[model samples]
Target chain A: MSRMILLTEGMSNPEEAKTATGLLRYRGEEVAAVFDSACIGETAQDVFGVGGAIPFVDSLDGLEADTLVMGIATAGGELPGAWRDIIADALRSGMKILNGLHTFISDDPEFASLAAEHGGELIDVRRPPAGLVVSSNEARNTPCFRVHTVGHDCGVGKMLTALELTTAVRGRGHTAEFLATGQTGIMITGSGIPIDAVVSDFVAGAAEQLVLENRDKEFLFIEGQGSLVHPLYSGVTLSLLHGCAPQAMVMGYDPTRTTIRHSAKPMPPIAEVIGLYEAMANVMAPSRVVAVAANTASLQESAARELLVSLGESLGLPATDVVRFGCEPIVDAVLEERRRVGEGAED
Target chain B: MSRMILLTEGMSNPEEAKTATGLLRYRGEEVAAVFDSACIGETAQDVFGVGGAIPFVDSLDGLEADTLVMGIATAGGELPGAWRDIIADALRSGMKILNGLHTFISDDPEFASLAAEHGGELIDVRRPPAGLVVSSNEARNTPCFRVHTVGHDCGVGKMLTALELTTAVRGRGHTAEFLATGQTGIMITGSGIPIDAVVSDFVAGAAEQLVLENRDKEFLFIEGQGSLVHPLYSGVTLSLLHGCAPQAMVMGYDPTRTTIRHSAKPMPPIAEVIGLYEAMANVMAPSRVVAVAANTASLQESAARELLVSLGESLGLPATDVVRFGCEPIVDAVLEERRRVGEGAED
Candidate 1:
C-alpha cells in the first residue's frame, strides 16, 4: 500500500480541510501524516477530534510517504501559488501527487515536466472524462434503489451523510454503492465523475453515467452537490437530482447555517426547501425526501439528540446527525421508502 | 463590414441551419452567399421563406467573402468531421472563421497552426471567459427591467423571442438590450456569454456577469436556454433563470410539440410550467411569466393565429408567434407587468 501525506497547509479548520478530514476518517490506514505548518506536532485527534494519533508534520524533511494528496478545497478549485515550491519538491523526490482541484497538475508545464523526469505520476481526480453526452435518463431504467443525499447548501455534510448511509445500508447485507459528485467524495470512493468540473450542459449526464455504471448494485447513495436555493450552484443540484432520478432523497442541512454562506439569500424553512426539492425531482420521476441528516456539530451531544427528535417529529421523517448518532435511523427510513415504492420498481 | 459566406453544407433546412438563418435574418448586409451543396442553386428565400434572395453556392471556390461562419448548431455542439476539409480550405485562403460550436476551432492543432500560418482569425463564440466565480446575487442590484425568455423545450424560439422583443421594445422608443446566452445569439448580437459552454459551477456567474455589464440599459431582454423539463440541459436553464433574475418572463413554446423533443418525458400543462418557472425565480425574488411567444412554424397563417389566441386566453397571458404575428402582444404584456410590479423596483 502507498503511504500518503495529506497537504492541508493553512486550512486546519475541519470545514476548510474537509478532504484531509475525510481521508483520515475513512481511509486512515493509508495516511501516514498530515502536512499543516500551523498544526505542526499536533495529531488529527487534537485538530479535528478524530483520526486518532495521526501526527501532523510541517514539511517533507522527515516524512516517509510516496504520495501527496491535496487536502484543502478552494472556492473555485484554483491551486494556491504558495504551494508550488512544496509540490515541486515532492515531484522532484519522485512522490506521486493526487490532486482533486479543478486545476489539473498534469496540464501545468512545469509540474508535467518535473513528474515526467522523476517518474512521478500526477492524478487529477477532478478532470472529467471526455465525450460525455447529454443525459438520456437511462438511470431510470436501472433496477437499483437510488437514495440521493441533497443539501440545504454547499459544505453541509451531504457527502458525509451519503457515505455513512451507504455503510449502514451495506451493513444490513444489501449491496450499496456510494456515488461521489465532488472532489473529496471522489478521493474517498476511488472513482467518481466530478460533476461540478463538467461542462454545464453535461452535469446531468455525468450524474446519470455514475448511476448507470453501478446499475448492478442494490442501492446507490448518490452524494449530491449544491443546494436548490444556493445562488450559484442550484443548476448543478437540479441536474444531479434529475439525472440520478432517485426513488428517495435524504436532505442534509447544517442547522447552525441560517443562510447560504457567501451569498445574500436567506435559507428558507427546511420544510419548504424539502418541498422545492421534491417538486424538482417530481418533474422527472416520483421521488421524496424520506429522512433528514441534521448537522448538529455545533451543539452538545444531548442538545443534538434533542433537536434531532423534535426535528424528526416536526418534519414527520427520521432525522439524525450521522456523526453523533449512527446512520441507522436514516437508513431505516430509506429502506421503508424503498419498500413503500416497491423495491427496485420501474416507473 | 466583412463579406461573409455561411457554411451550412448539408444542413439546408432552416432548423438545422439556424446559425445561417439567424445571420441572414438579422445581419443580411454582411452575408454574401451560403455554401450548402445540397441546395446549390436555391436562395435563402426558397429555403427559409425569408432573407430576401441571397443565393446558395456549391463551394467556396468562386465565393467573394472575407469570413466564413459555421452555420449548423450540432447536438452537443460537436463539429461534423466531414466539414473539416472545407473549414481548412477557408483557413488556408486567409478567411476568418466564426464558429459557434462547443468544439473551439482555434484549439484544434491543425486549425490553430493554419490560422497562425495564414493571416486568418478564428473566433469561438461558445468559448467562455476565464475567472468566473460563484454568483453573489449582484444582478438583483441592477436597476434595469430584465425580461427573460424561457422555453418549453430546446430550439423553441427562446433566443428569437428575446431578439424580437428587444426590437419591439426599441421600436417603442425604449432602450432595450438583448442578452445572448447561446452561440446563435452571440453570433447575432456580436457579444454575450455562452452559458452552456461554461463550467457547471459558473453558469449563473456568467449570466450574472452579462446582466451586470449591461446594467446601464433601461430594458434588458435576456435570452434563455433549454427548458426546465429538458433532461439534457435543464441545469443550463435553471442557472440562466436564477442568474438573470428577471422581473418578467416570456414563455416561449412550440404548440405543435407536446413533449421534450428527444426525451421520454411529456410536456406538462403550460400553466404548470409557468408556475414552476415563477416558483424557481421567486426563491431569489418576485418574478412572473407575463406573456407567451408561441412558435407556430408548423401551422398555416390563420391556424397559427387561432392557436396563439386560444393559447393566450387559456393561459391568461399575451401570446403571439413573434415570427408570424409580431412581438407587440408579448411586449405590451411585459410593459403591463413592469407597471404592475413598479418599473425597476428593487425588492
Candidate 2:
C-alpha cells in the first residue's frame, strides 16, 4: 500500500478534507495521516481518529510514502514554522512533494530551492491543457463537465449560470457536474469556510473518486462565487487544479456581479464576466474552450464575444474554435434532457 | 422583560454571537430569539435555544415584545427570495431592525430605501462622532489607547488589535463594551478551521465579559472580525452593531495580509498597511487615537508612523496627537506594574 500524507495549514474546510479522505480511501491509497494546525488534543483525536497529539508526527517520522500532498495557501504567505519543519523533514526523507497552491511558493526563493532540491513540483491546476485539440464529435459525445458551486444564501445564481454553461457544453456532447461545496442548512458563518479550502479538498476528493471509478474523462468545470469581491472561489480553483493535475481541460465562470447574492436581480455585466474569463484564461490557458452566457442581456453577448476572441487569439486558436452558447434554457434544459437520455438508456 | 429578536446571517462565528448575546443579556434585555442564516437546526438550537426554525419573524403576530432587535444583511449582492421576503416583512412590521454589517448597506441604495420605508434607520457605525476629541490622559486611560501583545496563531494580531483599542477607549472612563459578531469552530470542506477564529473569539469573549462586569462607563467598544473576506463576519458584525445602536463610537482595525492562512510568513508591505489604515481612518474618523505597532519589524513601525500621519492630516489633528506605542511586553509589564502599585497602595 502506498502511503500519502496530506499537510494542510489550519485554514482549510473540514468537509472538503473528509471528502478528500473518502476519495483517497476509495482510490486504494493508504492515507497515513492528516495534519492540521488547529486540530489539537481531544478534538484532533476525535477528528483525525488517531494519536491525539498537538503536533502529530506522521509526516515527520520519515514514513515511506510515494506522495506528500501539501495544501496550498491562497496567496504569497509562508508556511507555519511547524509546516516548514515537516516539509524540511519530508524533503530530507527523499519524499515526492506535490504542492497545489502555486502562487504561494512562486515568489519564495527558499521554497523554490527546496522544491528543486527535493524534486518536488508546485502544480498550477488552473491552467488548461497545452496544444489540446477538441473534436466537435468528442464535444458532442462528452459534452458536460463537473464543478463545485459555492456562495451565500441567495447566491445560487452563480451555480445556476455555471450549470447553464455546462448544458451548452453538453449540447456539443459534453457533460458538466455541479458539486455543492458546503452542505445545506449551514449558516453562512458556519458554512463560511474559505472557498480555497473547499476547492482543495473537493479536487483531491474528486480526483481520488475518479481514479477509483476508473472514469475516463476530460475537462473539469469550476463555478466561482457570484460576488467578484471574494477571491476564495478563484483562489481555490487555482489551487485544486494545481493539486489534482487532471488530464482534461479545466474551466471556470465569473459571475456578472462583483458581489454574489441569492436574489432576483439580473446577472452582472457581460463585460465583467468576460474580463474575469480573460484573466483566468491568461492564467490557466485552456486548450479547447466552450462558454455559455446565461441570464445575460443582449449587450453582454457582444462583450462575451470579444472576450472569447481575445482568449482564442492568445491561445493561438481560431475564434470560431471557441464555442459560445446562449443563456436561454441551455444549462437547466440540457441537463434535464441528459438525465432523460440516461434514464432511457438505463431502461 | 422586553423581548428582542436578533437575526443574523449564517456565516457568523458562533462564539462571537454568544458573546453578543451575553452583552445584550447584561443590558437588562431578554433575547426572545436569535436567527443565523448559516446555522442548521441542531446548531441553532445549541446557540440560540431556538429549535429548527428561522429565529426572526417579520410579523409581530404571537410575539410579545416592545423592542425587537434583528440583524440585517448589509453586504450588497443578490439575496435569496426568502431572505428578501424576510427583510421586507421585518421592515413592514415597524420593528427596530439593526443593520449589523454597516458596510454592506451603506454602499447600496436599495437597502437604504427598504430601511426608510420600513421605519428603520440605516445606521452608519463607522461615521465620525459629532465632536470627536482625544485627550492624552484619555488615551492613557482607555483600553483602546493601551498597547497589546498577541501571537501570530489564530489571527491574534487582528483580533487583539481591535480588542485592545476597544479596551483602551473603555479605560478612559467611558461606558465601553465589546460585542463579537459570530461563532467559532465550524468545519466545512477544507482542512480545518484556522486558529485566527479561535483567538478572535477568545479575545472578544474576554472583552465581552469585562464590558458586562463594568457597565458604568459612557462608551462601548464593539469588537468584530476585521477580515471581511468572509461575508458572514460582515453580516454578523453589522447585525450586532445595529442591535446596540446609538453607540458613542465604534472602533475597529485595518490589517493587511496576502494570504488566508493564520500563520503566513512575509507580513504585508508597509505601504499596504498604511493604505489600509488610511482607508479605515477615512471610514472610521476616530476622535482620539493611539496606534500600537507590533514589534515584528522596523518596517512595521515606519508603516504605523505613516498611518498616524496620514490619519492625523485627514482629521486635522496634530501628527503627534496620534500616540504610538509598541505592543510587545505591554500586557505583562502592565500587569506586573499594577500588582506592585496595588501592593504599595495597600501598605
Candidate 3:
C-alpha cells in the first residue's frame, strides 16, 4: 500500500470530507497525513473523534507521502476548482494521484504527461469500464453468501459498513471480499466498477461482473450506493441490488437524520424502507436484511445505543453503529444467514 | 413520424409483449406492421383488441417498413440471439433499426457499414452520453412545472403516462414535452437520455441536463422507469427524481397485481407508495403526487373504473388508466398544481 495524504482543503466535518473521511475510517494506516487548512493544528481525532490520531497538516510542503488522495466528495464527485493546483503540486513532487471524482485527471493531456514523467500514476476511480453490456443473470450461479450494504439515504456509511463487514468476517477465518460500486470505494479497493458512471441499464450487469470476478471468495460484501428511499439516486440502488443478487443485506443509515441528507424529504419509517428493499429483493433475488448498520456520527454513546436497541426491536434485526461498535453485529448476522442457507441447501 | 415494424417473437400475451404492445397503443400511426412469428396472421386487434388494425407478418421477406423497432423489452434489454439474423436481414433490406436493446448494433462493424450503405441509422436508444458528470443542481432553476411519472413497479405505464400526459397537457393549451429516460421512450420522442444507460453517478446529472435543456417548455413531463419500490432499478428512479427537481409528479402503477410482477414480493399499498414519492419529492423540489396513472390492462372496463374510483377515494388524488380512460385526470391535476403554484407566487 502506498503512503498517502488526504487533501480536504478547508472543508469542515466528515460529510464534506467524505472521500478522505472514509479513507481515514477504513484505510488510516496507509494515510501519512491529512492536509486540511481549516483544522491546521488538529488531528483526525480532533475533527472526527471516532478515527484514531492521524496527523493533520495545513500545507502540502514537506509532506513525505508518495501519493495524494482527493479527500472531498461533493454530491456529483466533481473535483473542486481549488484542488487543481494542489494536484499539480503533488505531481511535481512525484506523488501519484488517486481521484474518486467524476472529473478525470488523466483525461487532461498535460496532467497525463506530467504524471508520466514523475513515474506517478493518475487513477480516475469513476471511469466506466469499456464495453459493458446488461447483465445475463449469471450472478445467480454464485454460491457465496452475498451481503449488500444498503442505506436509508446517501452518505450513510454503506461503503464503510461493507468494508468493515469484510474485515470482520475474514477475522473469523472466512474469506470475504468487498465489491465496490462507487468512486471512493473503488479507490480504496482498487477494483470495482463505478456503477453510477456506467449507463443506467448496465449498472446491474457491471455489478454481476464484480460478483463473477470475485466468485472464489467465501463471502462477498458489496458496498451500496444511494438509498432506494433517496429520491435522486434510487435507480443506482435498485440496479446494484438486482445486480449483486445478494442473499442478505445490511441496512445502513445516519441515526440522527430525520430526512434525506441535503434534501428536506423526511425519511420514511425504517420499517417501510426495509419493506421497499425486501419487497424488490423478493422479486429479483430472495434476500433478507440481516442487520442494520447505523452511522452514529451525530449521536452520543447512550443515544446511539438507544437508537440501535429501538431499531433492533422494531425491525427485529441486529442493529449496531458500525463506526462506534466496529460492525460486529453485521458480521455475525451475515454468518448466521450463511449457516441458515447452508442448512437449507443440505435439507 | 417514421413508419416502423414491431417485433415480439417467442412471447405470450400483451404483458410479455410490452414494447411492441405499448407502441401499438400509443404510436399506432408510426407502426406499419408488427412481426411476431408466434402470433402470425394476428392483427393488433386480434392480439390485444386495443389498437386498430395493423398487419402482422411471420417473416422478414419483403418487409416494407422504413424502420424496424425492437419491440420486445426484456429485463436488462439484451438482444435475443435468435433475432440477430432478423436484424441483419432488415439492414440489408434497407430498413433502419431502432434498437433499444443494451447491445448496440453500431458496435458491430459489419452492421455499422451495412446501415451506412443504406443511408439508414443504427440508433442505440440506450447509449449513455459521453463525459457525464454528477448533477450540479441546475434543475433547481427551471420555472415551468416539472413532473416525473414514477411507478409502483417496472413496465407499469410510467413512459406511456408521461407521453399521454404531454399530449393531454398540450391539448389544454400548455406546452408539455415528455423527457424520455429509456430506450423505448427515446425511440418515440427522437430525444431522451435513457437514464438507465447512464452511469449511476451521472444519472441525476443527465436528468438535470434534460430539465435545463427544456427550460422553455411550459410543462415538462419527465418519463420515469423502475419503481422506487423496485430493488433492481430504484437508483435511476431516485436520480431522475432529484435531477429534475420536479414541482409535481404522477404516480403510475398496474392495478391488477397483488405482488410485484413476476416475483413473490408483495406490492406495497398504493397510498404508501404515493407517500414515499411525495416524501422524497417534497425534499428536493416540494413536488406532490398530483395524480395516479394505473395500468388497467388486466382489468375489464368496469373493473378498471372500480379500482380507479377506490384508489382516488383512498389516495385522495385523481386516478385513471391512461390507456383506458385517456389520462384526463392526470392532465387536470397537473394544470391544477400549476395553477396553485401560480396563485401562491402571486400571493
Candidate 4:
C-alpha cells in the first residue's frame, strides 16, 4: 500500500486543512503524517479531537513517502506560490504528487518536465477530461436510488452525511456507493471529478457520468457541494442536483449556523431550504426531501440529541447527527426510497 | 471587418438554428451568406418570415469567406459528425472557423495543426478562461445598475429583451451595454462568452468580471442563459443571477408556455417564479423583479396587448413584448432601479 504525507503548513484551522483532516478522520491507513510547521509537535487528536494520534512534521525536507498529498485545500483551488519551492523539491525527490486544485501541475511546462525526469506521476484529481460536454440526460432515466446530500451552506457536513448514509445502507445488507463531487470528498474516496474545477457546462454531465457508471450499486450516496442559497457556489450545487436526478435527498446542515456562508444575513429556515431543493429537483424529475442530517459536532451530546429529535418532529422527517448517531434515520429513508424507485422501474 | 458564412444544415427548424436566425436577424452586416444544403436556395425570409435574402450554398466547395460560423447551436453543444467534413475542408482552405460547441475544436491536434498551417483560427465562442475561480464579491459593491433578463423557458426572448432594453435606455439618453451570455447572443454581438462553457464555480465570477469590465456604462443589460424553471440549464441561470448582483431583473417568458423546456410538468405560475427568483436574488444582495417582458409571438396583436396589459396590472409591474412593442415599460423599470441605486450611492 502507498503511504502519503500531508502538507498543511500555514493553515490556521482544520477546515482550511480539510484534506489532512479528512484523511485523518476517514482514511487513516494511507496517511503517514501531516507537515505543518506551526503545529509541529501536536498529533491529529490534539488538532481535531476525534482522530487517533498521527505524527506531524515541521517541513518537507526529511519526509519520505510514496505520495505527498496537498492537504491544504484552499478556497479558490489555486496552487499557492508559498508552496511552490516545497512542492518542486518533493517532485525532484521522486515522490508522486497529488492535487485537487483547479490549476493542473501537469499543464505547467516546467513541472511537467521535472516530473517526467523523476518518473513520478502528477495526479490532478480535478483535471477533467479534455473533451467533456454537458450532461447527456441519461441519468434522468437511471433506475438507481440516488440519495444526495444538500446543505444550507458550504462546510456544513454534506460529505460526512453522505458517507455515513452509504455505510448505514451497506450495513443493512444493501450494495451502496458514495459519489464524491468536491476536492475533500475526492481526496478521501481516491476517485471523483472535483466538480468546482470542471467547466460549468460539464459539471452536471460529469456527475451524471459518475452516477451512470455506478449502476450496479443499489444505493448511490452523492456527496454535495456548496449551497443553492449561496450566490458564489450555487451553480455547482444546482448542476449536481440536476445531474444525478436523485429520487431522495438528505438536507445536511450544521447547527449554530444562522446565515449563508460568508454573509451576515440569517439563514433560511430548514423548511424553506428543503422546499427550494425539492422544487429545483422536481424541475428536473420527481423528488422529495426524505430526511435531514444535522452536524452536531459543535454541540454537547445531550443538546445535539434534543435538537435532532425536535428538528425531526418539526420537519416531519428523520433528523439526527449522522456521525454520532450512526445515521439510522437517514438509512431508513434511503431504503424506503430504494423500494419506491425499484417499484417504479418494474412498472 | 471579417465577413462570415453561417452553417445551419439539417437542423429542421429556425429555433434549432437560433445561431443562424439571431445573426441573420440582428447582425446582417457581418454575415455574408448561409450554408445549409437542405435550404440552399431559400432566403431567411423564406424560412423564418423575417430578414432579407442571403445566398445559401449546398456544399463547402467554391465558398470564399474569412470565417465559417457554426449556426446550428445544438442542445448539449456537440459538433455533429455531419459538419466534420465541411468544417475540415474550410479549415484546410484557410477559412477561420467559429464554434459554439462545448467541445473546443482547437483541442483537436489534427484540426489545430491544419488551421495553423492555413493561417486560420478556430474560435470557440463559448470557451471561458482557464483559471477562473469564484466571485471576488466586488460586484456586490459596484455602484453600477445591474439588470439581468431571466425567463420561464429557453427560446422565450431573454436575449431579445436585454437587447431591446439596452436600446431603450440608449434612446432615453442613458448609457447601457448588453452582456451576452450565450452562443446566439455572442454571435449577434461579435463579442461575449457563452456562460455555460465556464467552470461552474466561475460562472458568477465571470459575470462579475463582465459587469466590472463595462463600468462606464450606467445600465448593464445582461443577456440571460437558461431559464431557472428549466432543469437542464438552471445552474447557468442561477449563476448569472448571483454573479452580477443585479439591482433589477426582468422576467422574460412566452405567454403560451405552461411547462419547463423538455419537461412535462406545468410551469410554475409567474408570481411563484417571480418569488423564487427574487428570493434567490435576496440571498446574495437586496434585489427584486422590476418588470416583465412577454414574448407574444404565437398570439395575435390584440390578444398580445390584452395579455400584456393583464400581466402588467396583476404583477404590479410594467410588461411588454420588446420585439413587437418597444421595451419602454421594461426600460422605465430599469431606469428606476438605476435611479434608486444611484441615490443610494450618493448617500
Candidate 5:
C-alpha cells in the first residue's frame, strides 16, 4: 500500500478533488491525506465530508506515505514558504511526489529546480502531438459546423447548442455529432482550473472528435459555452483547423456577457474576437468563410460588416468570399442557395 | 441602424457580451434592444443600463431588427410559450433571427420546420483542433512534454503542476511545455455541459498548437485535471483521447470521489466514476497509459487495490501496466527514467 500527502497553499476545491478520488478508486488508487496550508480551521473530513480523505494540519508529524501528490495553488504561484517546507520535508522522508501544475511548469523556474532537486518530478500534460494524420473519410458529404452557447450554472444553453448543431448539420446533407466540452459551475466560481484552458482544450477536443468521427464531412462545426471570455477559446479552434485542415469551419457568434463590468475584463473586443476567427480561417485556408450574424438587427449591420471585412482581409479573402446573412430571410436565402448548390452538384 | 431583440431567459452573466458590445461598437455595430424575460419587477433602464442597446421585458411591441441573437437562458429548455410568441411575432414581422438554442431547433419541430420553410439555416460553429503543432523546421533536439495542473479559482495548483511537469519531463531528456485548462470556482448548481470539457479542451488545444507549430515531435503528453466523482469531466478527457490519439497519456490517480455509494434499495447502482475513464482508454487505445496512484494509506490498501484492478480490467489492460508512485520521489523517478530512455535513444 502507498500513502501520500497533498500539500497546497490554500483551500482547494474539495468537491472536485473528492470527485477525482472516486475516479481514482474506480481506477484502483487510494488517497491517504490532504494537507492545506490555507484551510486551518476545518478538518479535511469536515471539508470533504464522510468517505473523504483525512486532512493534516502539520506537515512534520512523521506522516509516512509511499507517495505525495501536491495540490495546486492560486494564480500568484507556489504555496507559501511553510507549505514548501512541508513539501521539502516530505521529500526528505523518502516519499515519492508528483506535481500537477501545468502553467507553473513553464512560468516558474525556481519551483522547477526545486522539483528536480527533491527527486520529485513535475509533469505538464498538455503538450501537442508527435504527428496528426487527418483524413476526410469521416466527413464526406456531411454538413459540418460548430455551435457555441453561453449560460451560467446548470443552464442548458451549451447542451442546447450541441443538440441544435447536430440537427442542423445533419439537415445539411451531412452527419453531425455533439462533442461536449466547456467550463462547469465549479470552474466559473474559481475553484479548479483557468477559463482560457477550459475553452481551448474543449474546442480542440471537439474538433479532434469531429475530424475523427466525421472524417469525410465537407465542413466542421463547433459548439461552445457562450459566457466564457477567453481569446484562446476561439484561438485554439483556429489552431485545430490549421492542423486538421477542415474544408470549412463555422462558429456561433454570441457575446452575451461582455457588457458587464468585472474585476477581470469581461470579453475581448469584437474586433479581436473576429480577428481570431479570421486568423483561423487564414490558417485553415477554407474555401469560404461565412459570417451568419443570426438574428442580429440591421442596426448591427455596420458592426457586422466591419467584422466581416476584417475577417476577410485577415484571411486574404474577397468580400464575396465572406458571406454575411442576417434575419430569417437572409439565413433562409443562404441555406437555400447552399441547398441549391448541393442539388446542382448532384445534377 | 438595425434593431434586434436580445432575449435572455433569466439573469445572464453579462461579462463577455458586454465587452464584445464595446468591441462591436468599435467595429461599428449598433445594438438596438435587449429583452430580459427574468427581470420581472425591474425597469428596462435599470436592467439594461444606459446604452445603445436598451433592455426590456419579453415584449414584441413595435420592435424591429434585421437579426436576433438569443442569449443564454437561465431556464434549461425552450422559451416559454409567451416568450416564444414574442420571438415568433418578430419572425413573422420579417426580422432575421439568430439564436444559440441549438436544442430548441430539434426540441420544437415547428421551429425547425419554420426555419426550413423560411429558408433560415441553423448554423453550428465548429471548434479548431486541440494541442500545439510545430513545424519540422522548428524542431529542437530536446523532447517536450505537456503538463496540466488543477486548482481553485485563485489557486495556482495548475500553474505549479505545469511548471513541475515541464521540469521533470525536460530533465528526462525531453523539453516540456505547460498548458492550463478547467474551471476554478464553486460547484455550479445545474446540469448542463460537463465542467471537465474546459480542461480537456484546453489540453487538446495546447497539444494541437504545439503539433502545428513544431511538426517534428513523435509523441504528446497530457496531464489531466485531478478530480474524483464527476465522470463527465473524466469522460470528456477520455473522449478527447480518442479524438486526439496522443502517443502516450499520463494521469494522476487520487480517488476521493469516484466511488459509487451502495444503497440497500433499488436505484441504479451509482455508476462507477472510473467507468468513463475505462471506456475512454479502451476507445483511445493510447500506446501508454501511466496512472500514478501512490496516495492511499495502508488501512485503505485493499480498497485501493481492488479499484485499481477493476480499472485495469475494464480498460482491458494488466494491473502492472498502471504505474503506482509516491508523490515527489516517484515523479522524480519517472521523469528521470523517461529522460534516460530518451537520451539513450538519441545516443
Candidate 6:
C-alpha cells in the first residue's frame, strides 16, 4: 500500500478539502499525514474531527511518503501557482503525484520532465478514458437497482451520501456498489469515470458505461455531480441524470446554502429543484427523488436533527445526514422505491 | 480563398454528407470539386440538386487543390477506417486537411507524422478552444435578442434553420449573426466553439462566451445540437440550451422522424418535446419554442406545405421548411416574441 501524504495547502475545513477529507475518512489507514500551512500543528481529527489523529505538517520537510496527492479542488481546477513549487520539490524526490484537477499534471512540461527524470508516476484521476461515445441508453439494460445522489450545489455531500448509502445497503445483505463519478469517489473506490472531465458529448456515455460495468451488483449508489440549477454545471448534472437513468434519486443538499456558490443566483426552492431533476430523469426513465441526504455539518447536532425531521415531513420523504446519523433512512427509501416499482420492472 | 476538394468518399446524398452539402450551399465558389468514388461521374448539382455544377471525381488523381476537407460525419463522429489511405495520400502531397470528427486526425500518430514531414496542416474543427470555465450567466447581461434553433434529433436541419433565420433577419435590415456550435457551422461562419468537444463542465461556458463575443449584434441565432430526448447527445442539447439562454427558440424537426435516430426510443409528441425544451430552458431563462422549422424534405412540395400549415396550427406556432420556403414566418415569430417579452426585459 502506498503511504499517501495529502497536500491541502491552506485548506483547513472539510468542505474546502473534500478529496483529502474523504480519503482520510474512508482510506485513513493509508494516509501518513496532511500538509497544510494553515493547520500545521493540528491533525486531521483536530481540523475536520473525523480522520483519527493523522498529523499535519507545514511542508514535506521530514515526511516520508511514496505518493503525494493533490488533496483539494479549486473552483476551476487550475493548479495554484503556490502549489507548483511544493509539487516540484516532491516530484524531484521521486514521489508519485496523484492529482484530480481539470489541469492534468502529466501534461505540464516542467512537472512531466521532473517526474520522468525521477521515475515517479503522475496519475490524473480526472483524465477520461479513451473511446467514449455518446450514450446509447445501454444502462437501461442493467438489472440492478440504481439510485443516484443528486444535490443543490457542487459540494453538498453527494459523494459522501452515495458512499454511505453503499455501505448501508450492503449491511442489509445486498450487493451494493458505489459508482464514483468524481475525483474523491474515484480515490476512495479505486476506479470510476470522472464525469466532468469527459467531453461534453460523452458525459452521458461515460455514466452509462459505469452502470453497465457494474450490472451484476444488486444495487448501485451512483455518485452525482453539480446542481441541476447550478449556472455553470447544470449541463453536467442533467447529462448524468439522463445517462444513469436511475430509478430512484437521493436529493443531497447543504441546508445552509441559499445561493449558488461563486454567483449571486438565488437557489430555487428545494421542491422545485427536486422537480427539475425528476422531470429531467423521466426523459430517459421513470424515476423519483425517493429521499433527502442533507449535509448538516454546519448545524449543531440538535438543530441538524430538527432540520432533518422537518425536512422529511415537509417533503414527505425520509431525510438525514448520512455521515452524522447514518444512511439507513435513505437506504430504506431506495429499497422501498424498488419494491413499489416491482423488481426490475421495465416500465 | 484556398481552393478546396471535399472528401466525401461514400457519401452520394445530402443527408449523408451534411458538411459537404452545407459547404456547397454556402461556400460553393471556393469548392473546386467533390471526391466521392460512389458518385464519380456526377456533379454536386446532379447528386444533391444543389451547389450548381461542381463535379465529383473518384480520386485525388490530377486534382489540384490546396485544402482537403473531410466532408462527412460518421455515426459517433468517427473517421471511417477506409478513409485512412485517402487522408494519408492527400497529406503526402502537402494538402491542408480540415476535418471535423471526434477522432482528431491531427493526433493520429501516422497522420501527425505525415503532416509534419510533408509541411501540411491538419485543422480539427471540433477541437475546443482552451481556458473555458463553468458558465456564470454572463450571457444574461448581454442585450442582444438571442434566439436558438433547438431540434427533435441530430441532422434535422437545426444549423440550416439558424443560418436561414439569420439571413431572413438580416434581410429585414436587422444585424443578425449566426452563432455556430458545430464544425459545419464553424466552417460556414468562420468561427464557433464546438460545444460537444468541450469538457462536460464547460459546454455552457463555451456557449456563453460565443454570445458574449457577439453581443454587438441586434439579433443572434445560435445553432442547436441533439434533441432533449436523444439518448446519445441530449447532454449537449440541454447544456447548449441553458448556456445560450435564448429569449426565444426555433425548434427544428423532421416531419417523419417518429423515433430518435439510431435508437429504439420513440419520439415524444411534438408538444411534449416542446414543453421539455421550454421547461429545461426556463430553468435558466424564460424561453419558449416560438416556431417550428421543419425539415420536410421527404415530402413533396405540396405535401410539405400542407404538413407545415397543419403543424403550425396544431402547435400554435409558425412552421416552415426554411430551405423550401423562406424563413419569413419564423423570423416574424421571433420578432413577435421579442415584442411580447419587451426589449431585453429581465423580469
Q: For candidate 1, write residues B1-347 as lDDT tens digits.
A: 88999988887776678888888888988999988888877788899776778998877887789999999886677888889999999999999999999888988999999999998999999999878877768887788889999987888888889999899899999898999999999998889998898989888888999999999988999999988888788888998888889988999988867777777788888888888888899877789999998888889889998998898789888888888888898888988887888744753
Model 2: runs farther than 4 Å from truth? A1-156, A167-176, A182-217, A223-347, B1-156, B181-347
Tell me, by DockQ, which candidate is best. Answer: 1
Per residue, candidate 3 scores C-alpha lDDT tens digits across B61-88 of 7655788888877776777888878888
Candidate of highest TM-score: 6
Per residue, candidate 6 scores C-alpha lDDT tens digits across A1-347 of 98999999877676668889889989999999998888877878989777888998877777779999999866677777889999999998999999999999999999999999999989999999988988878887678889999998888889988888888888999999999999989988899999998998889999999999998998998999988787778888888988998999999988888888767777788988898888778878889999998988789999999999999998899998888898888888899998988655853
Count of residue pairs whose backbone atoms collide, per candidate: 0, 85, 27, 5, 196, 0
Give stretches of model 4 more than 4 Å off: A61-64, A336-347, B60-64, B263-266, B339-347
Alpha-carbon interface RMSD of model 5? 15.3
The residue-by-residue lDDT of candidate 5 on B1-347, one tens digit each, is: 54545555454433223322221222224455566666645543454332443545566666655655554422112334555665565555555555433133334566656655665543211122333321111112224432222211111122223334445555666544433222211101111122232343344333344434433333333334422122112223332333333333333433432331111111111123233233223322223433333223222567767866675556443222121322344245445444545564432
Candidate 1 lDDT over residue span A186-244, tens digit each: 99978889999899988898899999999999999999988888878889899999999
**All candidates: CA RMSD in angstroms?**
2.4, 28.2, 5.0, 2.4, 30.7, 2.2
**How high is the lDDT of residue A4 in model 2?**
63
Output the better candidate (1/2) by lDDT. 1
Which DockQ value does candidate 1 get? 0.73
Q: How accurately is candidate 4 docked according to DockQ?
A: 0.60
- Residues A9-116 of candidate 4 have per-residue lDDT tens digits of 788375677777777778888778887778777887888664577777866666658788888666677787887777777788888888877778878887788889
lDDT tens string, model 2, B1-347?
44566655553443234323332323323555554545434343455433333353334556654333333322221223454555555556655543333133345576567767877654332221221111111121233222121111123233334345445644544444333322211100111112111211122222333334334444343333322222112212211222222112222223343442222223434333333223222211222222322322223677866765674456433222111453322333333333444353321
In model 3, the Cα lDDT at residue A204 comes to: 76
| Whole-model Cα lDDT of every candidate shown, in order | 0.88, 0.35, 0.80, 0.81, 0.37, 0.88
Report how far off residue A282 is in candidate 2 (Å): 13
Task: Name the fnat for model 2.
Answer: 0.00
How many Å off is the CA of A45 in candidate 4?
1.3
**Which run of 10 residues does model 2 chain B get worst, by summed lDDT?**
B184-193
lDDT of 5 by residue, A73-96 (tens): 232123345555665666555556
TM-score of chain B taken alone, candidate 2: 0.38
